[model samples]
Target: MHPSTLMMGYGYEPRLSEGALKPPIFLTSTYAFESAADGKRFFEGITGKRPGGSEGLVYGRFNGPNQEILEDRLAQWERAEEALSFSSGMSAIGTALMAHVQPGDVIVHSAPLYAATEKMIDAVFGKFGVKWVDFPAHASPAEIEETIERAKGLGRVSVIYLESPANPTNDLVDIEAVSALRDRMFADAEHRPVIMCDNTFLGPCFQAPTQNGADMSVYSLTKYVGGHSDLVAGAVVGTRDALAPILALRNTLGTITDPNTAWMLLRSLETVQLRMEKAESNARAVATFLKDHPKVERVSWLGFLDPSSSQGEIFKRHCSGAGSTFSVIVKGGEPEAFRLLDNLKTVKLAVSLGGTESLASHPAAMTHLSVPEARRAELGIGDNLVRVSIGVEHEDDLVADFEQALKAV
Candidate 1:
């Protein structure tokens, strides 16, 4: 069945909880065992001590009915063998990377990452004796090969991380090309680095990284997956083998999303496709308007990519649609960008994206402020750049909002 169809009822049974059509939130912290033997069996199953049947829940941190149901549905959507949920997107990413890398291991990642993620890799991980190297998201296949070779010279490459339709810039990394490069470089090695992709920008509806050879696909469910901007959650979906260690780490870190948030995600999944479709349509209209506006200097939207470009070819090969998030460069610098953002009536000046309501934010001063000015410029995140996340609003209303805001600029 189609993912949209499965969202309505998959992995859920109405008869299990007093005939409730919607699954009731299991708010308990622990589950009661039928017998001492049953408790032992559950523990054994979780610990992989014994293979058995009728294994039931042990604790909320370990497992819950709501978490299980949501994980199952998310796995199905991504065509992954298993799925795990986390308290936040960084928790999922940090735990997954930590699970795979040792103290001396190296991580090769794409540049222009989310500010928090970049800080974690370049600063926190470095202090712990792990090393990292970065390649541009638009790096050619040859450039990627050189980056990997350089990292290999430093230490063992344990992971290759990528974020496509990269945060605030709409830059894309070719998943298949990177995966093939990893395979060829590590053909004879005993341990091969895992390829992980952050799919939050495009969401599950727009792209599936697992289909393009990613060992894992990570998401900030707080974004498009939650849709209403009311919940915060994260998810990692991939093969059961690839996820086992990450799940163990998540369990130890106690980063599982609460039952209530899991329930909210379940509700959001049902309408995600519909919400994304409308937002994509609205974004195309808004981007087109920005491209033609006299006050706009440049628009960085995937839908506007030149078909003859390499990034465009990779996007056509891997993605189903150009998602709603993109960045616009205003004609002037910080002062003018602030004027436009401050004058926007319909679109809120905010940091987060992929919500139901339109949002506009200045990356240099807001989301990526921690990044140095030189690095920001290299990533095309300038003082005049405003990241816009189109919502499910009518196209005309959204365009009118931008029109008036540009007038202020």
Candidate 2:
């Protein structure tokens, strides 16, 4: 069944909720067990005293009605076996990484990552003796394998983390190739590293990372899934067994999404398909307008990509679309780029993406600032690059605003 069709009512029965159409917020922090025997069984599953049959909710930290239902819907969107929500995208990423690695373990990651994520590697993960190695998002499978091999030499490669259709740059990463190599290299190993992809840039509608080869697809639900720019949440969806450890970690760390946020996500998922598709359509229109402008040096939207190259093939094999968030390099460098952004009257100057209204920001000055002064340009995110998050705005109005804004440049 189509996900949108099922989003309204799947995993929820109104009959159990006083016949209400929508699921309630489940505001309580704990669930009441029928008897001591039932409570013992629930705790047994929670404490890992026994195996499986852990669906029974014991506490808010472990499970909640709204959280569980939202997870079910998100898992359906990614075609994953299970899903878990978190307080924020960083928390989700941190949990996913920490679940797989201990001291002396290594993480092989993709470059041009969201700046805070890069910071997290050194600030949080690094302090614990975990190491990280990075490869370009556009690297070939062989090159990536070389990076992983190098990571293994430092310590056991416990996680292969990636942010594909990379932030600000919008470059595609080869998920299928990475998954194939992981299988080939670790087939006989008892503990194989997971290929975890951040699907926030494209979300589930534009790209299915898990289907392409990733073991887990993570998202900052603050962006696309929430749709209205009102909530802050994150998610990870993968095989139940693969996510069990992350779930346990989330429980232990108390990073689970609050019931109110979970309920908001439930409301947002109902229209996510409609909202994202509209935004993508607007982005293509805006990208087309910017590409022809003399002041715009380059419009890095994937809409103009050639489908025959290796990167194109990788995109074609994985992503369903180019997505709405992309970068534009303006003429006259930083001064002109900042001028254009400052003069914008319609599009808001902001950092976050996937909202109902368009936004424009300088990645070098804002989102990717943590990438270090020298490496920012090396990563293809220069001072003149403006990252635009297209929204469900009227195409003609958006183009007109950008056109007038460019006159400042």
Candidate 3:
């Protein structure tokens, strides 16, 4: 069956809990075991002393009725062997990076990453002596190879990280090329690098990084997966080997999402396909309107990508859909961007994306400001760039809002 069809009840059984059609929220901190033997086995699994083999819940941090069901549904959607949830997007990313990265290791990352992620790698992880190296979003395959080589010179390049349809810029990164680069750079089995792709933008719906050889695919479930702005959550989906360490770190750090959030995610997962499809359609209309507006200088949207463009071919090959988020560079800088933003009546001027409601924010000052000014400029994100997360709003109404906002600008 199609994913949308499966989303309705893929991982849940109606009779599993009190014959209720929907899964109930298991709100307790821990679950009861059948006996002392069962408790010992569950504890052993939680602490990695033994394999529970999907028998029952252990601890709130390891597994729960709500979290287990949600992970099963999501893992199936992502075509992953296992999935893990976290408190927030950053937590998931941090746990994944920290699990594989260690002191004296290097991470080769793509440009225009989320400011929080950049700060985590540079400030937080750097204290532990982990090195950060940036690779151009538009770099040729050969150039990417060289970038990996340069990082290897500093130390062992343990991870190749990428944020495709990058935050703020809506740029594309070649997952297959990256996988190739990882293989070529770390052909030596002992020094191999794991490829991790931030699939938040395209997601388990529009794009699957693991299909292109990514070791792990991460998402800020707070966005499309949650589909509502009320919750904060993140997810990691990959093979058990690649995901086990991340899951272990999540347990130790207590970064797991609560039962309520997990239940909400399960609810949201059911409608993700419908919501994303509608949002993508709305985005196409919005991007086209922004492109023709005199006040808009440029638009970085997957919908408007040309086949002739360098990144265009990669976009065509990797992405089944041009996700719902895109950025517009106004003719003037921050002032004009703000003018348009302030004048909008339908869309809220806020951070975060991929919810049912439209949201807009300035990348330079909002999401990516923590990135150094020099690095921000080098990545081409200016004060003029305004990122818009297209929601389920009517395309005509959204276009009207943009029309009025552009007039004000």
Candidate 4:
């Protein structure tokens, strides 16, 4: 079934819960077990002592109606066998990292990552003795292989994390190439590295990382999945084997979303396909408009990829759409970027993306601000680059808004 159609009643059976059309928020912390035998069985299954079977409710932490239903629906959309939800995107990311990484292991990540993700790797993971090596967005397939070889020389490579259509800059990475490299890296039984992709930018809609051989796919459900800016949540979807540990960690860490948030996500999922399609159309129109504007130095959008461009083929093969997020480099630096941001009336000057409303942000001083200046330069996320997230608004209105905003610069 189509995702939009599935969104209405996937994973949730109204007949299961007093014939409620919508799954009611299982708003309690504990559930009543039918008997001591039932409690023992539930705990046994949760702790892996016994296999889980189709049965009655378990402890809230172990599994709740909201969490289980959400996971079911999410798994269907991403085409994964299972899924787990977290309280926030970073929690989902960090938990997945923690599950696979250990002290003295190395993680090779793609460049132009979301700033917070960088902090988790550099600052947070550094304390635990996990090392990192970055592969730039424009790096060729050979360069990625070489980087892995170099990292292997230092020690073991445990994880390869990628954020394609990388935040701030709309550069695309070849997931198939990376997956092939991962197989080579793990050819020896001594070391096997997991390939994880942050698919938040163009997730279950435009791209499916697992389809291209990624071990797991992550998303900041706070963005496109939530649709509106009201909810903050995250999710990781993968095969049952890859996601079981993540679910266990999630339960122990207590980073699960509440029933209300899960309900909101369910509602949002219904409209995600429609919302993303319109947003992508709006973005294509806006990007075309920006390409012809004299003040815009360059537009980094996958939709604009030239046939000769190195990333063009990868984008064409993997991405269903160019996504709604793109960055434009103005003639001047921070001053010009801010001037354009400040002048926008319809598109708000904000940090988050993938919402119904358009938003513009400056990487140098906003999302990527925490990244060191030197490192930021190396990644090509410059001060002049202004990121815009097109919404379902009128394209002409958005174009006019950008035209007027460019005048301010």
lDDT of each: 0.91, 0.89, 0.87, 0.87
* Stretch of 10 with least lDDT, candidate 2: 46-55
Q: Give the TM-score (vs. native) of candidate 1.
A: 0.98
Model 4 reaches what TM-score against the true structure?
0.97
lDDT tens readout by residue for model 3, 47-144: 77876343678777777888888888778766889888889999999999999998989999988788898899999989999998888777788888
**Ranked candidates (lDDT, high to low):** 1, 2, 3, 4
**Candidate 3, residue 223: lDDT:** 94
Looking at candidate 3, the ten consecutive residues that score lowest on lDDT are: 50-59
Stretches > 4 Å off in candidate 1:
50-54
Q: Largest lDDT belongs to which candidate?
A: 1
The alpha-carbon deviation from the true structure for residue 394 of candidate 2, after best TM-score superposition, in angstroms, is 0.6
lDDT of 1 at 143: 98
Stretches > 4 Å off in candidate 3: 51-54
Q: CA shift at 377, candidate 2, in angstroms?
A: 1.7
lDDT of 2 by residue, 323-355 (tens): 889899988788999999999988999889998
Name the lDDT value of residue 244 in candidate 3. 78
Residue-level lDDT of model 1, residues 14-61, one tens digit each, is 998899999999999999998999898888877767643227888888
Q: Which portions of model 4 miss their true places by more than 4 Å? A: 51-56
Q: For candidate 1, list the clashing residue pairs, or say none.
A: none
TM-score of 3: 0.97
